[model samples]
Target: MRRLLGRRDFRTIFIALTVSMLAESVLVLALGVWVKDLTGSDGLAGATFLALSAPMLVAPLAGWVVDRIPRRAIFVALNVVTAGLLLPLLTVRHAADLWIVYTVAVGYGLSYIVLGATVSALVPELVPADLLPDANSALQTVKQALRLLGPLIGAGLFSLLGGAKLALACAVCFLVAGVMGTLLRSGRQAVRMPTTSDRPTWSSEVSAGLRHLVREPALRTVAVCSALSMIGLGVGESLYFAYVDQGLGRDAAFLGILVSAQGVGGVAGGVASALVVRRLGEVGAVAVGIGLFALGSLALVQPALWLALPASVLIGMGLPVSMVGTNTLLQRRTPAHLLGRAATALDALVSGPQALAIGLGAVLVGVVDYRLLFGAIGVAMAFVGGTLWFARRVAQPAVSTEPAPAQADFPG
Candidate 1:
């Protein structure tokens, strides 16, 4: 813990990212609520979120840029673009046109990937090697906290002034994020240039990341676990607002409470994840994390909304636990130059399934009850955990505290 506190640059980056995320979380909720008010249709609001998720398929090109291009520029430019998008959003006088809201959300989805991959990839460059697990845990915990709090604030503000004002607030938040992102500018030189994975064609590059990932036994297992989790959790959360409103028969405040509770859980998990890794070994900790996620997801099956709080918390913690463990393994296994490509590869796997899950969730919510949906999520999670266990005993693990001589070290 003390070692984690010592990484000043990582801490700075963490603070910048956390504040940005907090504001973003609030703004997003506020924007959706405003859209609902304007259109007088929950369906349009749903459309907006779907639009946001729709861009996942197009993300590899963006991921390619993230890897090849400079980190600072990606972070800075994406922030500026986001801020610019939000500025026009402030003028959304009438959300009556579903298309308009959809367009804005599309902008959000496109810009979202830039910051996500950039920030995560950049952190390893800033922190000490040994402290990465702790740093990752520390960073994720803070973002989780912001995610919890952002909505309540957004909802509260929305209650006060309504539409244009909400847009302005969200715009200002983006502007703030842009400014904060600039403060963490370690510049392009901070990240070492990665090796060429392919002949630089977009499709070929995508394939390279995929091929490299497939060749590694450990990363493949991690991918399966994370992707399945996304399917279940993604499906559940996609319809969560409606679920809370209908299933739990709760009011808005109760919904906000559950969201915050999840954030609290995320922070708890992030803070503890490193310790879990340190004590449990990467495999043990990750398995436990996935198990928790599956169980927490099952909580959505509960009749009482309050009862789902622990489940939300469990979901929150599980995210960082699995992420940190998986990422750390990748760093240790992949060569320094291939790390970015390797990450982009993993992102595609995670994102593609989630994109599909979002559409699936949209369709499923119409027929299946939230309880049954959560049950399906739990079953999917079991598949993931089962795969991991089977893979562990048979295949070679990609990572270890001590490097193995049989496998290549740092795939240069």
Candidate 2:
């Protein structure tokens, strides 16, 4: 752990990523509050998520551009531009105008989409291939931990100074991230940049990514499981509030506890995954991780908050494990030239289908009881896990490639 923390490159990006996450968290919590204030409806606040969901639909296109371009330049520009883009809110009141919010959402979500791809693709270049899982676990530990904190901070900030303040804070985080990207340098292109012309067709560029995905069985399996997980996430988002409020009758404080528990669990999970990666290699680690987390979703079943402790921890452990695995796989298999593109596609799968899943989940919330929804999604994820687990056995994929130093001897 100490060795991992000492990495300059990872540390810099980690700070930048954490700051950015903090900003986004504030923006989201603030947005929900603003939307609620505007519409006087909790449902409308939920719809604010729809704004976040929109850009995800085009996540593939974003990924294609990410793949072809100099990822560093693109990411830096995006973050810097986002900082400035958010400046308009410093004075605006009457934020209820749906149009203004919608516009902001589009830009915000789009920037996030590309920035995420850049970060994911950049990781392998920053650290050794063998260190990928350790690096990933460390990174995720930062992201998940900060996310849990971001929402609460957002709410507190909103209480003190409202939307403009929240936006300003977010802008600052983006600005800082941009600065980090601009100042930092990579050693050498571990992978070469793919050749492209000034007049390339968008459809063709996207097709390259799609084809790459289609060709790689490992990538396909990973994508399938990831997509399903996103769907499950969408459903959770749509119904979790109600489940907490209406089903379990938990208070805001209790809800916070559950959320915090999830993060804490995730952090522990990340730590454990580092050890697991040391043993299982990257692919096997992820296979185990996803299954564990997929199985972890069982937390939704236990109604009592006390039951949530172990449930959330088990579920959290699965997340970083799966995420680190998938990301490491992509980093190892993908050429530097297409790393951004492939990563972008992965980003799209993470965010795009998730948006749809959230929408479907939202719709389902209106139609079914919360328990039924939880049970149904849980079963669905379990099925997805079974399919993936079996695929791993059949594919008989080669021994895990270590993303970290000690990872080479997997299944040890």
Give the clash count for each candidate: 0, 8
Clashing pairs in 2: 67-341, 129-403, 130-403, 130-404, 131-403, 131-404, 132-403, 132-404
Residue-wise C-alpha lDDT for candidate 2, range 1-412, written one tens digit per residue: 5554566666667777777878887787688788787678888787777787678767777877776566667767888999988887665576456657666877888888888778777777667766677877887777777676777788888888878777887898899998987655652343344356655566866666667766778787778788887778678767767767886787656666666777887777766776776676555666676566555566676676666666666666778777877777777776655666787777676667776777788888888987787777777777776677666643345433223222122121
lDDT of 2 at 183: 57
Q: What are the lDDT scores of the predictions, listed in order?
A: 0.69, 0.71
TM-score of 2: 0.84
Q: Across residues 1-412, which tens digit of lDDT does each residue of candidate 1 receive? A: 5545544555456666766676677766766787788878788766667777677766666666666776766776777677778666655776455556678788887777667767656665565456667877777777677676777777887899775676666666667666766765353533444357733665776566567678876767777777877777677777787667887787756776777777887888888888887776555566667877788877777767566778778887787787777766665556443555677678878868877887788888888886788888877786676667555542244343222112112222
Q: Model 1 Cα RMSD, Å?
A: 5.9
